[model samples]
Target: MFILDIFSLQQNIDFSLRSLTISLLLGTLLSLALKIHYQRFGMSLSNRVAFSKVFVFITLTTTLIISIVKSSIALSLGLVGALSIVRFRTPIKEPEELAYLFMCIAVGLGLGANQWLATIVATTIILIVTIRWKRSEDQSLFLSLDWEKSHNIDLDQLQNCLLKFICDCDLRRFDSRDEREEVIYYINIANSDNLLSLIQKLKTDFPQIGISFLDKTTIPGV
Candidate 1:
């Protein structure tokens, strides 16, 4: 009889078991969608795999927490106190990443509070806008070059070459190690049409130097 009582208590539902299950499942699936969206459209320099993986966990955890505490003020306070002991040690390197993180958290909170309609509608709008903006716009890019200082590069000639191809070509990073020099510059190249020509010119003048664009990735279909 005692064993039966314990089993029955274990099976008891708090604030509708069906609702809890549905919210968690929906939140998890939404998080997965957002992860795919970010993976395809994110322009951050930091690799996104680590941060993207956390969305599902965060959403599910938040849903479960809210499910447990939604009915009582004391439980809510206890939840807060419990959460206060936790620490977020992972460093977010980009403001964009932070923005995305907050959005994911908001989704979890909304779903946890059982505001499914609001969460779904808002997430859909924001997701579509973000993807479209990233895909249709000219994203930011920088240029970097590395070569041996012994190569005797002419700064004036290089500046003239860059000026013909790009706007606001300003040197922002300069480094030297032993015999090699590394230089980074901010450049505005609105389109890829002139990129090959610029590369050809650079190669003609400095055949042995390494030249490449920074914060650039080969995102498929972007």
Candidate 2:
């Protein structure tokens, strides 16, 4: 009888573990869905990936903690302590990133509560709507031009040249030191090929000018 009881307990434990695993898997799927939907917008690719990975781990761990353990007081205290000490050092400049993080956490919680179907259905609808919204807008382009301090180029003339090539141009930032200025331009162009051709012309016209092109993937410091 004792052996039979032990076998029954083992089966119950296995069933519970299987349920938890399914929950975590559903959560991960929901997170991925959110990522795909957000990517259609002007979201930073690398930042999105990093946020997704972090949230997935966080949700999975939280689900495990809340499921297997059945102590409300301990859970409440742990949550308080966790929130009190948590700090994010890396600066998240975009507000959209924070929204995505919250969505990921919500899906995880939903799955942990054994609401896998709801999580999947809700995420799917959200992704569809986001993709539709992205289709309505044009993609944005960024161009950065860096030159040596010693170069004596006419900034006004350069700006004129860029204005002719792009639909709109703005001086986004300038890093100046020792009489040197690294000017960054945020341009809205109808086509990327036009921007490339413009850069080539600039290179040909001023071979001595230290000009560079950058995209969304380029980091500010690097």
Candidate 3:
């Protein structure tokens, strides 16, 4: 009897198909907007285009799931149980990517709960603030360094030297298995003179090292 009570379905509310359709359409549009904003204003060094492609799908799926479950208490409990068995193993490489994903989920949840006005207003405000903040931040450049393994470069020394000329350096990739080693970095250069100084210093200190600078427009489609 208790088990039956636990599994019993509630009298579903009079759900509105028209409202669901409207929420889905709005969610789709918002997702696309989020995707574009992320691709343009995001600071992550990963593949923004590929990462953001899931936004629309995630938003719609979330909205659909929430709309279906929200009408019944039993279904909501069932959802919790169903999700308990699911495991998301894909790692998020950057915090910014995770934040964007959360925003996508928020849009879905808000619209699903029929808070369309709040969702739209909040999302717009957040995007505007994010764009302004990102624009105000320092500019960064993609830098690639390659050298023979025989050069025996010290990474710590290289980074220490980098700090003298750049505001910050983030090492994105490193490979040292072959005779040739390579490193990728996102560096913040304050001015052209600092950039020139860094280049000349690298040439003098590590003559065998190869240096390359790639702008965002040129590399990995951003």
Candidate 4:
């Protein structure tokens, strides 16, 4: 009886199989593209692979959910309930990760809705633009630093050391709490190798400092 019902339902939905197949393919491709984009832009290395998995899973799940839930009220209430129960305790440290997550979700939704051509076209354009932006010299690198015994450091000397390696640098944020100062720098370098050298110098000069680096490919979350 159940198998017969399943067959009947499958026959009734005209594009069910097509939508599912396309959604899966698009979700996989889009997730890969977004991951490549994030890496190219030098996003934070920590939890990146895990985050990509989450992004892809969310995209796939949301796509199927949107496709199956037809009634507006049911969809709205179900979404609310589903979201309410979801507690993401892991705070996303980078804003760009949030953006990529959303983009993946959008691509999934588009594919689920049978907007295949649009999804492909839009994603290609975005990928191209991101690649070009990454190659440009105007992009800034984000640096996270934790200075131990903050009083031991001289801001002028640190700035001079950084300036020697980069063409332009700016302090984006500084937080001093619990005997540690967290400093973030936006630096424009002539090349990616130069950026790595600057980070190495920071470690060599101040062995006690904890340093992390990311680039412009970050996305913001709501």
Comparing 3 with 4 on lDDT, the higher-scoring candidate is 3
By lDDT, the better pick of 2 and 4 is: 4
TM-scores of the candidates are: 0.65, 0.56, 0.65, 0.59
**Model 4 whole-model lDDT (C-alpha atoms):** 0.74
Lowest lDDT sum, 10 consecutive residues, model 3, at 5-14
* Per-residue lDDT value at 51 in model 4: 68
Candidate 3: pairs in clash:
none
Q: Ranking by lDDT, best first?
A: 3, 1, 4, 2
The segments of candidate 1 whose C-alpha lies over 4 angstroms from its true place after superposition are: 1-14, 149-184, 188-222
Error of 2 at 77 (Å): 3.9
Candidate 4: stretches off by over 4 Å = 1-15, 42-50, 70-77, 137-165, 168-187, 190-194, 197-222
- lDDT tens digits by residue: candidate 4, 40-159: 564354566666767677778767876665324445576889888988897767776877877888887787777789988998898888767766745467878887665578877888
Q: In candidate 2, how many Å is residue 86 off? A: 2.8
Model 2, residue 195: distance off in Å is 9.4
Query: lDDT of each prediction vs. the true structure?
Result: 0.79, 0.67, 0.87, 0.74
- Number of backbone clashes in candidate 4: 4
Ranking by TM-score: 1, 3, 4, 2
Q: For model 4, what is the alpha-carbon lDDT of residue 138?
A: 57
Clashes of 3: 0
Residue 89 lDDT in candidate 3? 94
